[model samples]
Target: MDDRHSRQSWLEAGLSQLAARGADGLSIVAVARELGVTKGSFYWHFRDLKDYRGALLQQWEAQYTQLAIERMEADGGSALDKLRRMLSLPAAGAERLGLALRSWALSDKEVARTLKRVDARRTAYLAGLYTQLGLDAARARTLAQFTYHALNGRFLLGDMVPAAAQLDLLLTLLTAPNDEAVAETAV
Candidate 1:
């Protein structure tokens, strides 16, 4: 591999390691050994552990964030359908990227901060979508929070909730407007 590919390979390898073993077991020496390269190779791509972590965050944002937003914004469906897909993302991935990221955030301050920011962006984007759907600000905010927590909870539940049933519940609740109060219609 060339320089760029080599660097990405190590970063990806690092994330995979973190996923399987958590950050406590991640070490430059270990990643170097896995790649069959010297520790020096890790330096060529990353300045230090922090740099590698930053790269991992960047990789995550690049690889997953937009795809998720796009999935949530898919055409011709009730917002509930979009919401259900967002909730089901973690279970759908064999690698459990969502769980991995959540695990990383538990031990890494920077990762935690970035996760919060990414979540805020997602929530805001979803709130805007809700607003466009005719929800009031408070209702939109509540829906956004509900959707965010629902998805996170869904990831944690995994096998406990049958995938199909969990998705069905989310679609039913999230797609429908908050309450059937007078003077307001569900989007």
Candidate 2:
């Protein structure tokens, strides 16, 4: 813990706090205490709590969604390979942060809107990858939705199901042929 904190450091602390305690736990005082600094340090980095929150949302969006899309696109593999890589990408703390934001969205319209936008961007990226794998538009969209839903569901279910087993089912669903995917979704 440094005496002085960078803006990024504050944002990271905010994210961790959000994950651990949800929106109500995110405060300048809390972040400052976590960083072993005074609240003045937070004010130095952000104009106010609103500004800090906006920056936190932007950081989450960039790190969780935009950077992920960049990594998948730059993977330089077959579309299927890229898709698998995207699916298996290990984002530590992402599930916690996602759950926190989703809970926050229930009480904040802005957070809900931001969450919706992020979900759309992620879903579109997955659909694009599926389209590259030669699935038609309709089927690609269906698989994309299913993939996103399964991922979220896994997070929601947490330890109720084994991670390995859930991942296996996800892989089976994602890598299946377009016809099979459509049929499975229909059931």
Candidate 3:
């Protein structure tokens, strides 16, 4: 809790606040108080609340989506392995922030647009992975949609189901051969 704070620190504080009290509670004054710093410290990093929010969104995009994709791509594994790795990645509090952002999106056009773009990027990445696993384009897209939907559903539901159980179901859907997967899962 130093007087001097980094932009990343401010963003992290913002996400934590977003999780605890929703977007309405996310403000420079609140975050500054949370960090035991002055408003000047927050202003040092961002031009204003709007600028802070934009940076926060960018950080969320990078941490939640772009970094995940990069890690999957860099892994030395087959498409199935990569897919498994991506699915099994730990939430690490990002899920709560994501849920908060989605809720905020319901009333904020800018947040809605950003969430839409993030979803598109994520689904496109999943589709590409399915394609690399030898699925046809249509099948890949379908699987991508299903996979992304399941992920967001889990977040929306606050993961009441155990993590192991959810992963088992997701891995079964994602790893099984296409025809067999459809037949077995009745999807």
RMSD (Å) per prediction: 4.3, 3.4, 3.0
**Candidate 3 Cα lDDT to native:** 0.81
TM-score of each: 0.75, 0.85, 0.85
Residue-level error in angstroms, candidate 2, position 129:
0.8
Residue-wise lDDT of candidate 3 within 85-143, one digit each (tens)? 66665566767888899999999898999999999999999898888887888888989
| CA lDDT, candidate 2, residue 66 | 94
Q: What is the lDDT of candidate 1?
A: 0.70
Clashing pairs in 1: none
Evaluation by TM-score, superior candidate among 1 and 3: 3
- Candidate 3, which ten residues in sequence have the lowest lDDT sum? 154-163
> Which one wins by TM-score: 1 or 2?
2
Tens digit of per-residue lDDT, candidate 2, span 1-187: 3635888899989999999999998988888888888898887789998899999999999988998778767767887777666656554667889999999999988899999999999889889988887778887898899878877876666623336655566655665676667478547
For model 2, the stretches where C-alpha displacement exceeds 4 angstroms are 1-4, 159-187
Q: List the pairs of residues colliding in candidate 3.
A: none
Residue 120 local lDDT, model 3: 95
Ranking by lDDT: 2, 3, 1
